[model samples]
Target: MHTTEHHWITTPITADILRGALDLEHTEHGVLPHRLPARARAQCVDGQLAMAESQPSGVRLVFRTRATAVELDTLPTKRVYVGVPPRPEGVYDLLVDGRPAGRAGVTGGNTLTIDLTTGTAEHQAGPVGTLRFTDLPDSVKNVEIWLPHNETTELVALRTDAPIEPAPDGDRKVWLHHGSSISHGSDAASPTATWPALAATLGGVALINLGLGGSALLDPFTARAMRDTPADLISLKVGINLVNADLMRLRAFTPAVHGFLDTIREGHPAAPLLVVSPILCPIHEDTPGPGAFDLGALSTGKLRFRATGDPAERAAGKLTLNVIQEELARIVEQRADEDPNLHYLDGRELYGQADSAELPLPDQLHPDAATHRRIGERFAELAFTADGPFTDRSA
Candidate 1:
C-alpha cells in the first residue's frame, strides 16, 4: 500500500498581508485588526465605537498562492440579544482572482449576550474555530478572505498546502468611506455583500470602510483618522447616525461638519471628496430622533426601531433627515467654490420614497441584503461612472 504525505505550512497573520485595517494589535490569542488606530481609540471610551470598529467590515487577507486547500483559525465574538432570535453565524468569503469562489462560517467562539431592556451585557467564553476551504484550482491566483462584517474576529492562524506570498499592490485607487450602521453591513448577507464592498468591486477601487454602527457622530477623532489615512477617493455618509443618536442640534451640527471637512482637507488637499446625506427613511424624515426599540415588535422575536422625538421638536432645533439633507447641501455648495474637488450627492438618489416602497427596511433602520445590492449598483452607476463625483479622471 502506498500512502501520500500531506504537508501543511503555517503562516503568521501580519499587517503586510492584510488590507482595509488601519492598525493591527497582537492579542494573547491572536492578532486583532482595527479600523481605527490606537490613538483614536484611546480618545473616546465609548463601547459602541469600540465594538463597531473591531468588526472588520471591509478588512481582508490578500495573498498569491497555488494552494488547493486553506485553513484559517479565528476567535469570533458573536452578539446575541436577550430576547430576540440569535443572528446567523458570521460568514467568511473566499475570492479567487477577484471573484467569489467559496463561503463558510465559523462554528464556536465567544458570545456577547445583551439585554436591551436593562442595557447590560454578559460575556460567555467559547473555543477558537477553524474555517476550511478546499478544492481550489492549483494554478497561481490571487486569493482574498474577507472577514465577517458584523462580528469581531481575531485571526489566530493561517495554514495552507502551499507557500503563499502577499499579493503585490496594483494601480487600483483606494476608496475610503465612512458611515452609519447601514454602511456597516447590519443586515447584509455577507461581508462582501455590503454596499461599499460591492461598489468597490464595481468601481475597481480598493476599499477602506470605516462604517461604525450607531457611531458615525461626526466625532473629531474619527475625522482625524480619516484625514491621516491615505486614499485617492473619499466619501462621508453622514446624517443617519447623527439623527438617531440625537447627539447634537443644528446649532452644533453645521459647524461640526465644517470642522470635520477642514480636518480631512488638512491631510488630503486634493483628493476627490464626496459628501453623502442620509437615505430616505420615512420614520425619521419628518420626525426627529433619539430612536428607540419598538416594544411591540419585541414580542415577535425580532428587533425593530422607531423614532421617539416629536415632529414638533424640529421647531426647537431638533435634527431630522430633512433638516440634515438641506444643511449638508448648503455646506457642500458653500465650500465647493474654494475646494474644486469637493462634491455632494443627495442620499435620496440612492434610496428614496420609491425605493422604500419596493424594498422596505426590515428593521425599520437597516436595509436588507437585496436593498444593499440595489444601493451598491446605484452608487456605482452615479458616482463611479460618467460625470459623477467619484469618477476616475485620470482614466
Candidate 2:
C-alpha cells in the first residue's frame, strides 16, 4: 500500500500578515499582538488594561494562499474564575474570501485563575496548542484566521500545505473603535462574531477594535494610542465602563471626554468622529456603580453582575447611564458647531428598552450572542447607510 507524504511549509508570524493590532511583541515563545503600543502600555500599571489590550479583540492573520490545509501553533492564556464552572475553550474563526468557512478551538494552553472576592489572579503555565483547518479549494483565495476576542494569544507559527503570502490591501476605509467589555466580545459567539467585526463587514470597512474589557476608563494613554493609529473613521463607546468601574465623577468625566476626542482629532482632523453613549443598561441607568458579581449566581453555575452603588449618590456628582447620555449629547452638540465632522449616537438606538425586553442580558451586564448580532445590524444601518454619520460623502 502506498501512503501520501505531505510537505508542510512553516511561516513565522509577523506584522505584515496581521491586521487590527497596533503593535507586535516578540515573546520568548511566540509573537503577541497588542492593541496598545509599548509606550502607552508603559504608562499604566493596571493589570486589567494589560490583559485586555493583549486579548486582540479584532486582530486576525490575513494572507493569500491556495493551501489545502493550515495549522497555527499558539499559546493562549485562558481565564478561570475561582469558584464558578470553567468556561469553554476560546474559538478561532477562519474566513475564506471574506466569508466564514470554519471554526476551531485549541485544547492545551496557559491559564490565569482569578479570585473575584479578592481581585487577585494566579498564572499557570501550560503547553502550546495548534489549530488545524483542512480541505481547502485549489484556487487562490484570501484567508483570514481571526484570533479569539477574549483570549490573550501568542502566535507561535503558521504551517500550510502550500506557500502563503500576505494578502494584498483591499483599500477599504479603516474604522477604529474603542468600547467596553460588550464590544470586547464578552458573550460573542466567536472573534469574527463580535459586534464591531460584524458591523465592519456590513459597512465594507476595515476594523481596528480597541475594545478593552473592564478597562475602557477613558485613560489618556488609550486616547494617545488612538491618536497615533491611522484610521479613516473613528468612534468611542464610552459611559458603561466609566459608570461600572466608578472611575470618575461628573466633573472629571466631561473633561475626559473632551480630551479623548481632542487627542483623536489631533491625528484625524477631517475624519468622521462618532461619540456613542452607553446602551440602555437598566442596572446602571439610574444607579451608580462599582458593579459587583452576584455571589448567589455562582452557586447555580452562572456568573452575573449587579450594580452596587446608590442612586442617591447622583446628588453628590456620581454618574449613571442617564446622566452620561445627557452629558455626551450636550458635548457633541456644543462641539458640532465648530467641528462639523463630529457626530454623536445615543447607543440606545442600537440596543434599547424594547430590544432588551426581547433579548435580555444573560449576565445582566453584557449582551448575549443574539444581541450582538442585533446591535451590529442596527449600527450598520445607522452609521454605514445613506444619511448616516459614517456615510461616504466622497462617493
Q: What is the C-alpha RMSD of each candidate to the true structure, in Å?
A: 1.4, 1.3
Per-residue lDDT of model 2, residues 230-342, tens digit only: 99999999999999999899999999999999999988998999999999889999999999898888767779999999999999999999999999999999999999999
* Worst ten in a row by lDDT for model 2: 2-11
Error of 2 at 167 (Å): 0.9
Clashes of each: 0, 0
Distance from true location, Cα of 148 in model 1, Å: 0.3
How far in Å is the alpha carbon of 395 misplaced in model 2?
A: 1.6
Which residue ranges in model 1 land beyond 4 Å of their true spot?
Answer: 1-5
TM-score of 1: 0.98
Candidate 1 lDDT by residue in tens digits, 173-242: 9999999998898899999999999999999999999999999999999999999999999999999988
Report lDDT per candidate.
Answer: 0.94, 0.93
